[model samples]
Target: MELQPLATFRVELAPVLHVGRTRWGDRRVIGIVGGSFSGPRLNGEVLPGGADWQVVHEDGSASIDTRYTLRTHDGALLYIQTQGVRHGPPEVMARLAAGEDVDPAEYYFRLFIRFETGSPDYAWLGRTLAVGTGRREPNAVVYDAFTLT
Candidate 1:
């Protein structure tokens, strides 16, 4: 299958709430404050109140679990969920955790994206499968999403 450019998302985040180590792993909840997304097919602002519930495993790989809402320019509301992983060498991960501006190539961050909506105009999204590559900034996470065709 080929990949087609879908959209670029820049999600703003609040400070992480450390939940300590649970039976699963080191848990952290990051508040999704606000953000924006744009592309050929979709453009909108990310609504607040969503969050990422992250679990960092023993091997230092993080399980990316996020759910959020998107309001398209024309007024369609879409539900978005993403699952993936982010991992790298010790030093690289450390740099990222320290909020350094390291190159994305220094680590691996990828996601599988899904969308759901009741709006007829955006119903196509319900059947669309997407993937994304991510980068962590000091206060935001940015990613470019591509739809699988």
Candidate 2:
């Protein structure tokens, strides 16, 4: 199967709420303030209120889990969920944590994305399986998504 370009999205985030260390790991929650997305077939704005519930492991790898809403330009509401991981060399990860604008290629951040919607115009998304390569900016996360076809 070939990977088809799906969309490129930038998710704006608020400051991270560190929940401290737990048995699982260091948990943190970052509010999804706002953002936008565009592609050949989909274009929309990300609604506020969603969040990323993340867990940083002892080895510095982070488990990325996020849920959010997307409003299409045509007025369809869609639910979006992504699960992924982000990791890299210790020094690079440290720089990223320090809020530096390091190149995305320096780290490994990837995601498995899922979409759900009841609108007939976007019904095709329900059956599509997508994957994304992500980058953590100072206050946002950007990713280019691809669907398996």
Candidate 3:
């Protein structure tokens, strides 16, 4: 008999984006570093690991209550569902695999977040908000990727 390992599902802490809103024509930044469930004590601690999230950093962190459709490494994209976008280095993924600490700057790019709110607003950011991913998404989703140059 042949043994195979099915794709078991798991959830991990995603990238913590520095969610900031710009005003005065991008001159000012109003950032909300915390969310609804960032406290020392919460009533939902006994739940499954995925059910409760800990905002370790009050300055910029939150439990992911959102999902996203993203481009896969295979050059295809799918909106499976995402937890949140975290800010860190590629070591985060590596550390998750090896159980080690990694410097946040090691990542090539800062993780951008996507939430599955069913709101059209999640499609784009800032000036790019006008273009929606659409109900019937195209073959390839063009990304106006945000790269810190």
Candidate 4:
């Protein structure tokens, strides 16, 4: 299979709200305030009210689940759900949490991105399998998603 560039999106996040440890793990939620995306075929802005629900394991690895809505410039709404993992050395993760400018290559942040939309203009997204590579910025997380063909 070949991977084609689908879209690249930059997600602006609010400060993470810690939920502390539960029976499952250490839970946290990052509010999705706003963001935008631009790509060859799709361009839009991410609406508010979405969130990333995270579970931090004992080993410092985080399992990520994010659900959000994307409104295309042309007025189509797409539902986005991405499941991913982010992990690295403790020091590296600490630097990220401190909002330091560390190299993304030093850590592993990847996701399986999925989309659902009833809009005819974006129906292809509903059938594609996409993967994303992520990097943590000071106030946002950026990711480039590619579709598998």
TM-score, model 1 to reference: 0.98
C-alpha-based local distance difference test score of model 1: 0.96
Candidate 3's TM-score:
0.21
| Clash count list over all predictions | 0, 0, 10, 0
Off by over 4 Å in 2: none
lDDT of 1 by residue, 1-149 (tens): 99999999999999999999999999999999999999998999999978999999999999999999999999999999999999999999999899889899999999999999999999999999999999999999999999999
Tell me the whole-model lDDT of each prediction, alpha carbons only: 0.96, 0.96, 0.25, 0.93
Cα lDDT of model 3 by residue, 52-116, tens digit:
12232333322333333332222233233223333343435445335444443443221232322
Q: What is the lDDT of residue 38 in candidate 4?
A: 87
Better of 1 and 3 by lDDT: 1
Q: Candidate 4 lDDT, tens digit per residue, 3-102? A: 8887789999999999999987999999998999988778989898799999999998999999999999899999999999999999999999899998
lDDT of 3: 0.25
What's the residue-level lDDT of 86 in candidate 1? 100
- Distance from true location, Cα of 108 in model 4, Å: 0.4
Once fitted onto the true fold, the runs of candidate 4 whose alpha carbons sit more than 4 angstroms away are none
lDDT of 2 by residue, 115-149 (tens): 99999999999999999999999999999999999
Ranking by lDDT: 2, 1, 4, 3
